[model samples]
Target: MLLCWLLFIPFIGGLACWFVSRRNPDSNAARWIALASMALVFLPALSLWFGGDFSLPSHLSASPDWNRELSVPWIQQFGIAFHLGLDGLSLIMVMLASVLGMLAIAASWSSVRSRVGLFHANLLWTLGGVIGIFLAIDLFLYFFFWELMLIPMYFLIALWGHEEYDRGAHMRAAIKFFIYTQTSGLLMLAAILGLVFAYYSETGILTFDYNQLLGAHVSGTFGFVLMLGFFIAFAVKLPSVPFHGWLADTQANSPSSGAADLSGILVKTAAYGLLRFTLPLFPEASAQFAPFAIALGLISIYYGAVMAFAQNDMKRLISYSSISHMGFVMIGLYAGTFLALQGVIVQVVASAISTAALFILAGQLYERMGTRDMRQLGGLFGRLGALPGFALIFVVASLGMPATANFIGEFLILFGAFSVMPWVVVVASGGMILAAVYALYLMHRVYWGTPQGQETIARMRAREYAIMMALVVITLIVGLFPNTVLSVTQGTMNDISHWFAAGVIAASQAS
Candidate 1:
């Protein structure tokens, strides 16, 4: 019941926000509706954080078990149910949704003047869909919400994004996002259908339930094709290298607020999907392809870092940096080591914190300078004072400075990668160097040298500082004592690790 309420609260509130315009279609009602409803969603998530157990009572860490769950027959005739659940994997994500959702509302507090009600409406709905993705155990429900998320986002980008985005920019970005994910969505649906049918053929049971499909048998070629379907869907969202073409345009044209949600929470769904759906669903294929996948992660790291160094536009640079960060996340995930999996958990949380912080700060910088060009940005460190220093901390943390959370994540990833494949680790190290180059270059260009006039030097606001400081404190605390996250995650990852090991051995024997 708590799990169901957690997902439904935002949805019901989002619908109510749409009606805010009826009494007075102004943005205030919409904003209030968004804020108030999101407040409701937070309660259930808080239960998991402080009261409910984040893990099972067992000694091992990783498992499919969720600490809180809700289930009821939705389509009993077809064996589908309104099944929803949460474990360490999704508990963290829902918590992120609540926090970032609140902050994004804050970011848009004064920035979005037009269609205020509509904006919050879209924002709340988008989150509802994301929460659905995290909790839905039914395949159909998962895909339904997956597509549900796409619509509100399309509106958010096309309607309220940067004015320079003009008319077609939003349409173009929205359409591109739709096409990429929709195509991949179709592929994933196919795989889901295949799994259900495969289970039915063997056991005379037709169900879209995850538990039922887990040990269903399939041939190598079959698993390979199905896994490809799932992988492509996850990869496009991860926006891994070749499939990443949509990210830059979306970030560049969309409102900074929309970009925050997209970068901070939306793209993460792909990584989450990879862990929850793709790898676990097709373990044999995943194990068979782990080495190749690790190579892709390595490639994305260096490629994104190098490209980030070349970009002068603030949004685009961070967009590319997101790519680089997810690269490490992907590598660690595929490594199948305990430490590496722990690194993935830290990396996901830290990446969201650090990258989103940079994006928000960049938005502030843009508001000040009225430009994102490196050449136009010169030292305002004296004028900006503490902000530049704070920005530097985020930058170095992003660059993986030794004591920062980013360093802890990278260290674990490298250590885990080395244990599995030393040569891959050797190559992946170059990404760290490239990250330094780009991060420092951006620092020098944006915050160093002389002041480019005194035009863009407004001191940081209390609200923005509060939001950023929260992110800062989280990075420090999580980095210093990683066990805070690791302890809860250890059991879950170990269960997942053993699951994949069996698949790897099976695949090897078959080959």
Candidate 2:
């Protein structure tokens, strides 16, 4: 019931916001309604997290576990159920979604003036769809939410995004985003049908339930083919190396709030899909594919970092940096160990917060200076006042500085990945050095050089300060006691590792 409410409130709130905006076009009611709805969501999500048993002992049982769940029959003919569940894995993701949901709302308060009602409506809808993605345990339901998320995001970029001296710029980016994600989604849908039909062929029982599908017996070439469908779907969403063409454009032109959601949570969904679906559903295939995937991660690390250095656009630089950071997540996931998987979870959370903070900061810079070109900006330290300090914090965090969550996540990923693939991990580690160069170069160009003009922009407002400070505090706390997140996910990662190993053993024996 509570799970339903978490999903329901945002959608209801969006309609209410639309109504409110329609009635009072000049009022700030739409923004407040969106913020209030997001705030309300945090309570239920928090309760779900604390209500669970965090102790590892609880996981000793050999039974499937779910801390909170709601299952009801839906679409009986297709074997789909309105299934939702929360475990340690989903709890953190939901929490991140709610937190960033609010920040994205707050970040839009002043900037989004045109179509205020419509904008807030889209924001809430996008968030509602994301919450669905995090909680839905049924594969069909998961893919439904996956496709739902993109529509509002396209509207967001198309209607409210930036256009630097070009007509239809935002629209083009939005179209590119739509085409890529929608195409990937079609691939995922095909894979879902394949898996369900495969299961029915063997057992004569049709279902789209995640747990039931885990027992699927498809193997050899057929299993490998089904796994490829899932992997490609997730990989496109991950926008890894070769599939990353759409990200830079989308981020570069998107409104700050949209970019925050994109970098912060949208991309993380891809990582989550890999963890939640691709690996567990087809573990043997994942193992067979790990070497090639790790090589791609290494390439992303170097490619993203180097390309970031070449970008003159501030948003593009941050977007490329995002690619590099996610590369570490790729390494940890394919490394195939409990420790490495834990690091992947930590990296997902930390990278989202840190990257979102930078996007928020980037928005702030654009608002003040009227441009995001690094070359045109200079010596903002004296002129912009305290924003430079906050920007510096995010910049250092991006570079994996000590005492920050980014540092902890990267260290663990590298440490765990080293055991399985030392050479690859060593090669990927070079990203840290390149990260430092690009991160500092951004800082040097934006805040430490000569001012571009005498255009005096306002200092950080209370709302902006609150947003950045909250992100900074979160990074610190997670860095200091990563166990806060690790403990919750430890049991889940252990179970997944076991599944991977068992599947590999089964596949080899069959062959």
Candidate 3:
């Protein structure tokens, strides 16, 4: 019941915000309502984090253990149910979504004056769909949420995005994003259907239930093809290398809040999907594909870093940086070790916080200076007061500075993956050096050079300061005591590691 409410609150609140805005367009009622709704969602997830029993039993099985689960019959003939489950893995993600959702609202508070209510409605709806993606265990249900989140995001970029040079640029970006994701999504849908039909043929049970489908006998060329379908979708969402074409433009044009969601929360879903569904559903195929995935991860790491260094647009720089950061996540996922998997979880959360903070800071700079081009932005360090300091800290964190979560995440990922794939880890470590170069270059280009102009920039507002401080605190805490997150995700990661390892052994033995 609580799980159901967590999924529905954002949607309900979005509608409520829409109605309230229609009645009182000028009032802050809609904002408060959306915030309250997000609060409602966050509170329950936090309680689960604190109070729920997530420990695994001494004896493990092929089936996973859930902290909470709810299933109701929806399509009996097809073996589909409205199945939802929560585990430590998902609990952490849900909490991240709720917190980021609220901050996105706060970020958009003043900048979005027109259609304020509608804008927030889309924001909340987008978040609702995200939570659904995290929770939905049924493949049918997962795809439903997968596609659902894109529409509101399209609206967010298309309707409210910045249009500096071209009026239609934002719309074009939105459409491109939609087409890329939607087309890849359809491929995943086909793969899902193929998996369901294959399972039905094997066991004479037609179902989209993930648990039931998990044990389905899928192998050979057919299984690999289906796995590719899922992989392509997640990769595009991850925006890994070749499929990352839409992300820079999309983030470059989107409103700040929208970009924050894209980098902070939305991309993490791809990592989650890979962890939760792809690896578990088709472990053998995933094991076979690991090497290639690592290669692509290497490409994204270097490519994103190089592109970010060359960018003058601050938002585009951050967007490309996200592609680089997520490269570590890809390597961690396929590294096939317990420690690397744990590192992947930490990296997902830490990167989300640090990257989102950067996007928010960029938005603030844009608001004050009316530009995000780094060439046009220099020596505002003294002029912007604490904003430059905030940028410096997050920029350092982005490069994986110690005492920040980014450092802990990247260190663990490289350290853990080195044991399994020494050569790959050796190559990936160079990305950190490149990362520092870009990070320092960003600071030097934007805040350390000669003053761009003598404009009177406003100091950080209370709301803005609070947002940055909150993120900084969280990053530091995770950096210092990562066990806070690791403990919760340990049992889950152990189960996945064991499952994948077992599949590897089985495949090798059969061969």
lDDT of 3 by residue, 1-511 (tens): 9999999999999999999999999999999999999999999999898898777558766667889999999988888899999999999999999999989889888889999889999999999999999999999999999999999999999999889767899999999999999999999999999999999999988999998988998987898899999999999999899999999999999999999998999999999999998888888888888899999999999999999999999999999999999999999999868888889999999989988999999999999989998878788888986899999989999999988888888888898899889999999999999999999999999899888678758999999998888888989999999988988888888888887787677667766
Q: What C-alpha lDDT values do all the predictions have?
A: 0.82, 0.87, 0.91
Instruction: Give lDDT: candidate 1, residue 395.
Output: 91
> What lDDT is reached at residue 381 by model 1?
79
* Model 1 Cα lDDT, one tens digit per residue, 1-511: 7787888888888778778765786547777778778777876676667665555346633337677777788888788988887887777788878878887877777677877777888998899999999988888889889989999998898887665525577778878888888898899999989888888999998888876677688658987888888888889998788789999878777777788889988998998888887777777899888987887898899889988988878888989999999899889888877788778888887888788888788777777768777777778777774678788988999989877889999899889878778988888888888898898888888888977676546888887788778788888988998877776666667767777777788888998
Model 2 TM-score (2 dp)? 0.97
Q: List the residue pairs that clash in candidate 2.
A: 378-450, 379-449
Minimum summed lDDT over a 10-residue window in model 3 is located at: 55-64
Candidate 3 wrong stretches, greater than 4 Å: 452-456
- RMSD list, candidates in order: 2.0, 1.5, 1.1
Best of the candidates, TM-score: 3
Please, what are the lDDT tens digits per residue for candidate 2 over residues 1-511? 8889888898999999999999999999999999999888988878766677855544443423777789999999989999998778888988898899899999888888899989989988988898899899899999999999899999999999898757788899999999989988898899899999999998999899988998887677877888888877777777788889899999999999889988998898999889888888888888777888888888888899999999999999999999999889988988878888999998899989988988888898898889899888888886775789998998999888889898888988899878868988778878899999999999999898667666556988899889988998999999998998998887778877777776667757766
lDDT, candidate 1, residue 176?
A: 89
